[model samples]
Target: MSFQWTFLATFLYCELIVVIILLLPFISPRIWQKFFNSRLAKAFAAGAKYYFNFIICVFGLLFLDSIRELRKYANIDSKDLSAPHAEAHARMKQFRSQRNFYIAGFALFLWFVIKRLINLLVACAREMSAAAEAHKQAEGATRHLEGVMAKDPTKIDPREIIASPNNPPRYVEAKEHEFEIKKYKQEISKAKEDIDTLRKEYEQSMKKYNELQDEHQKSQIQLAKLSDNESSKDK
Candidate 1:
């Protein structure tokens, strides 16, 4: 081969390698996700991915080396395809075929990795959201329990106004009661704020409920009118 022919072949091979690398990411997204999600699979995929890259690099270097040899041969004697040259040519041709096969396989793997990863992420998000919602409901229930304890009539809950005529001012008990009263007052303020917020939410929900009821009534009236029209038509 001439120097120009050798250069053209090298350029074409490099282009082919680039195209294969670019396609791998899109084709193996799911495979990547699955592999990355588990520790064992992640390790395996990392090793495999690196090995694949290494093999591609080796092939690329070999291709370049072969092209350089071809250029050297062309420079020395353009027409000779003798023993050593023929052997080199055969190896280069074999490498090209093997490279194509590797490219196709890697592309499939890449696609699989990406798809699996996306699914895992969506599942994880849904689980996290459900957990958060449950926590919020539990916290609300706890706050309501605390408020009920603060206001129970029978239970001499230390948190409320426990004023009695006989226990006018025993200094120790008075101080303890003062502290409890202060704590309950703070809780009361917080509960009031919550009640205001809930009132607004209830009002909005009631407004929507009334709107739906009105819509239902309208729909009933329309249905009755249609029935009457049909009855008249029959008559």
Candidate 2:
């Protein structure tokens, strides 16, 4: 009976050690990786650590008590449970704990790295938007300046011509072209506004011309009637 109990206790202790060793790799990976990849995994892992630690302590205490009971009831050899082996196990546990501590530090480092990367992306987007806006504004200003130069090509800056000798003329025969464009635009606007006035004047002139023509026709008829009356009276 004592041998069976000792064997069972040894088996349980071995199982616990196997579980702890297997779990160390999972528990010590960067926290952010788990947080981003799977929240459920991260939670499970955290919970597992606590439960595993509790089980280890419980088993250690149980094994110590079991050894004491074996010594009293069965007279097992004391040489088998050496202090050096226990001390070595204690040191191994301490190493595993330190390794886990480093994992926490790695998690923090990864978090900062990801955060800075996001910030850089946002900043780049902002800079691109600003550059695009500035480019649009510059294009508009260039167009406006070109129009001004077209209107007075003869007054070009000699300094610009000298500095940019290789650059081709942007506005050849510009003064005439600019004047014609300006004149056409003005005529178009004036014609639209003067349409009503022109219509009114045309109607008035037509009325005057019709009245004169009618008066001339009536005088011709009156003269013909007078000539006819004189001929009849003479007869």
Largest lDDT belongs to which candidate?
Answer: 1
lDDT of 2 by residue, 1-235 (tens): 3453444445445555544443454543333343434878556767765775665565455455544543443432456447658655555545544433333333333434444543454565567768889997777666656755786544444323433578765545557599888899999999988998899999999999999999999999999999999999999
Clashes per candidate, residues 3 or more apart or on different chains = 17, 0
Q: Which runs of model 1 end up more than 4 angstroms from their true locations?
A: 1-84, 152-235
Cα lDDT over the full model 1: 0.61
Question: Residue 14 lDDT in model 2?
Answer: 56
TM-score of 2: 0.29
Q: What lDDT does each candidate get?
A: 0.61, 0.57
Residue-level error in angstroms, candidate 2, position 102: 1.0
Compute each candidate's TM-score over C-alphas. 0.30, 0.29
- How far residue 31's Cα lies from its native spot in candidate 2, in Å, is 27
